[model samples]
Target chain A: QQPVQSPQAVILREGEDAVINCSSSKALYSVHWYRQKHGEAPVFLMILLKGGEQKGHEKISASFNEKKQQSSLYLTASQLSYSGTYFCGTVTTSGTYKYIFGTGTRLKVLA
Target chain B: NAGVTQTPKFRILKIGQSMTLQCTQDMNHNYMYWYRQDPGMGLKLIYYSVGAGITDKGEVPNGYNVSRSTTEDFPLRLELAAPSQTSVYFCASSYRIMPFINSGGGSDIQYFGAGTRLSVL
Candidate 1:
């Protein structure tokens, strides 16, 4: 099933912080975060595996809660380059090689 | 490495016309996927392959088909395309994680293609 993302859209000023949440109905084995700029391919940000681990990339970070079947992407001190649509791809506990992406969260960071 | 490459960056097809979106990965990844992204929406998986000759349907596979004849190539076929099939198609590949050895640190990072924009009228 496709995951659901909260705060369909968010606007932040430079240096501001924002959080994007992704929740799945099924148990998840891993959660992958990606950001897509306008007319560009989705770029891999980070992947959070089960065991409630947290991962970070630059000022961005993510946490996965296997028990809750949810993950959250954190963007601190946002930059203009941070403006993009954030998507979360989830792999369920079925151990399949498929990834179901979330609806997406559009973040626009202004100067 | 070119990473994931897709052909025919833009295409326009009439209703009922069929076309194939080509995807190739130089990373030698074992896992490949096909997804479509409609405007203002996230990607929806159409098909995936764990390895050469091993393909499977995904969440939205009704209007499309896929084949993995080689480890480096996975193509998506749209038979009798419809207006609903018009969207940006993306091909992605990733390294499959072993059962327990690399489960904790396996690189599940999926490298994406440039995307093919298809318009069906």
Candidate 2:
């Protein structure tokens, strides 16, 4: 099933902060994050596996919670280059070789 | 590596028109997927294949068809186009696990194509 993300849209300024959250009803084994620019394909940012692990890219970090079936992305001191749509994908291990992505969070960073 | 490549980067179709979006991956991945992204709606999986002769439906597979006759290619066919189907299409591939830490031929990190932007008028 597709995961759910909070605060569908967010606007930030340079040196500000923002957070995007993703939660799923089904148990997820892993969570993946990707960013898409205006007219480009979605680019992989980071992945967090179960076991309460965390991964960081530049100043951005994501945390995966096994018990809660949720993941949160942290954008600390945002930059202008951070403008884009963010998607969170969840994967399970029930022999179902498929991954479901969230609706997406649109973020606009203003200078 | 070219990773995943999609043909016909942009196309416009009238009502009832038919077309096929071709997706190919250079890496020999067993898993391939097709997704459509509408403005502000994120990405929805339309179809996916686990292997050469296997295919499955996703959330938004009603207005589309797909086939996986070969491991190197997965093509999505629109028998009749509609305005609702006008969206950016993306093709991706990956393994089930472990692309974050270890480098492997097949990892969970899905590589996406440049995408095919389709518009139905």
**Candidate 1 C-alpha lDDT tens digits along A2-111:** 78998899999999999999999998878999999999999988888765889889999999988889899999999999999999987777654446789999999999
- Candidate 2, residues A1-111, lDDT tens digits: the string is 678898799998899999999999887778889998999988989988655898899999999988888999999999999999999987765564457888789999999
Off by over 4 Å in 1: A95-98, B100-104
lDDT of 2 by residue, B25-106 (tens): 9888888999998866688889998889999998889989999999999999998899999999999988643343343322
Task: Judging by DockQ against the true structure, name the best candidate.
Answer: 1
TM-score per candidate: 0.92, 0.92
Q: Considering the two chains of model 2, state its CAPRI-style docking category.
A: medium
Report how closely model 2 matches the true complex, as a DockQ value: 0.53
Off by over 4 Å in 2: B97-106
Instruction: Give DockQ for candidates 1 onward, in order.
Output: 0.70, 0.53
Q: What C-alpha RMSD separates each model from the true structure?
A: 1.8, 2.8
Interface RMSD of each: 1.9, 3.7
